[model samples]
Target: MFDVSEVTVIAVDVFGTTVDWRSGVIDGVAAIAGHHETEFDCPALVDAWRERYLPAVGQINRGERAWANLDAVHREALDECLEVFGVAGKFGAEARERMVRAWYALPPWPDAAAGLAELRRDFVVVALSNGGFAQLTHVVKGAGLGFDAILSAENVGAYKPDRRAYVNAAKLLDAEPRTILMVAAHTWDIHGARDAGFRTTFVERPGEKGPDRPADAAETTDCDLSAVSFADLAGQLRGARKGVDAGH
Candidate 1:
């Protein structure tokens, strides 16, 4: 088994890893659209909105655009998505603003709260995400999540996978990159953390993309550990601790 002896802090990716973002976004969009008494496919619109995320973030990563918070990014994408969905004329500034706020109140996955509690029994678990500080705080409060600390991209003035974000987070935690375990449901996130010198864990979240689109797959031989859920991750870490104690 891979060793966990060096892992002192667990940095978890928030959106897809800890919360059901797809469902949350859909519900939020549906609420706004339904309130307008307009009929449209909220799910399809949500998926389109999500597809725009990586490209927008990619622009920041490539230095093609200035730094913007997730709310702003979501707003820009929402506008584009509305045009594409042929509902651009329907949603005004107020309606669009409410839809953007929906991102802050996502519900946690079934294993999230409990698994986080289990991990906290042995390690410092922090919310390390691309979300803004306020957004992350609201999500933690709304979902009743337990995080010893929060390390947001906003804190470092850069988004995830960015060299600045990970570097600053490790500094803030007073932990070496090697001592921090970056756990994420997305392979791209794992690869980013690994490139930044953090050990990585790939947690499968097949439902992240919803029913039609498949979730991201881990790059071959990329992750240090693979788990089906947060509970399984806790169990593996527990086993590692037991094995270490027995060996001594």
Candidate 2:
């Protein structure tokens, strides 16, 4: 395992890593359908919504449009998605808006809340994600997911894989990037965080696919740590520390 105690703060990525976004979005779409006996394609809708995500962020990053949080971008994507699925006017304004707000009600993964609770005991735990501040706050509150602080791409004026996002997180927490371990489920996120000079840990949820080491692999692999779940991650990080740090 990597030396985790060297990290003063553990910044987490939300969405798929901390919460089950797919289930939440599927439920929202079903609610929107409203007993119409419609057989909707949840996977298709989820994929399509995600497909538009980066383009929306790129628009803001390129200065073509002012920066908007992930919540607003999700709304825009939701509207486009509903229209594409032939359900444009099916939902009323209030109902449609609630569906958009579902992002705030994301449920924590089964092990996420408990693992975070444990990990928080030994480290300064925070959310470093692409989620908007309001959205992250709402979701964390709704799920009773405790965090010491929250940072997001919205604050950085850019999205993940952008150096600004990672740097902004470390800066706000007054910690060096190398001393911050970014725990995420996505390899790309881990790669980006590492490129930005932060240590990275990969938490592999069930059904979550990531890197597979090849035979005779080099020691210079990207992720600093990897685990099957947050509980396992807690164990790994805890084991990496030889002595207790007072600040944590």
Candidate 3:
């Protein structure tokens, strides 16, 4: 129901939307645990660590806690998870810091790299994430993600679904809210951007939260466009652009 021709930029959510955080965190934690001859439920530990993410950011967004970047939030959650899992003493400060940096080394989803390249042909592609500037830069470079620009909630001193994050991204891109497309795997993310007057595109990422946990079916109707992967999204957008061009 929306016009692709109107979209001047595509701002994507980087965490679960573009990169697979669960697998990356699990791999990183398990590697560290293994090296230390420690035993714990790796998946459970990762899940527990991630479960703290939103609340940690929300504390800042709600002004209950002083502003902190995603790296700080992840470290806090990691420390808590280590204690809860009874593996706190297994790693020293250096090893724990390395584990926190695991967020930077996450792999992009299967469709992310190529699909992003395709979409970049017609629109400015950038990252809009809660991760700090350094964190996002590492991920983009490590994964070789070709974003024209990278934006972070750190820039606004807040995390999403805060409206300022989206608004500031639009302002940075010099585009109106309606002229930008917010692409994400999380419905809450899309909902936030849509509420901020930006168009939304929901990309389904199965197992974003955990294995076998696909994106909610209800999310399909909540956005201007829905696709199973970034490839499908690129195809749809390219076709829409073709139609617009032919008419012109």
Q: Pick the candidate with the highest TM-score.
A: 1
Cα-based lDDT for every prediction: 0.90, 0.78, 0.88
Candidate 3 regions exceeding 4 Å error are 212-214, 218-221, 246-248
Candidate 3 lDDT by residue in tens digits, 1-248: 57888998999999998999889888988898899899999999888888899889888999999998888898889999999988898999998998898888999998889989988988899999999999999999888799999999978897889888899888888899999999998877888999999999988887788864555553454889988887888889889988988989
lDDT of 1: 0.90
Cα displacement (Å) at residue 244, model 2: 11
Find the 10 residues in a row with the least total lDDT in model 1.
212-221
lDDT digits (tens) for residues 1-248 of candidate 2: 55565688888888878887767776776776655555566567766887798788878877899888887898889889878987776666776678778778877889888999888988899988888888888989988888898887868788987788898888898889999998887766788899999998877754421123221111333788777677898887776574445435
Could you tell which candidate, 1 or 2, scores higher by lDDT?
Answer: 1
Q: Which residue ranges in model 2 land beyond 4 Å of their true spot? A: 35-39, 208-221, 243-248
Worst 10 residues of 3 by lDDT: 212-221
Better of 1 and 2 by TM-score: 1
Query: Residue 204's C-alpha lDDT in candidate 1?
Result: 88
Candidate 3 global TM-score: 0.95
List clash counts for every candidate, in order. Answer: 0, 0, 0
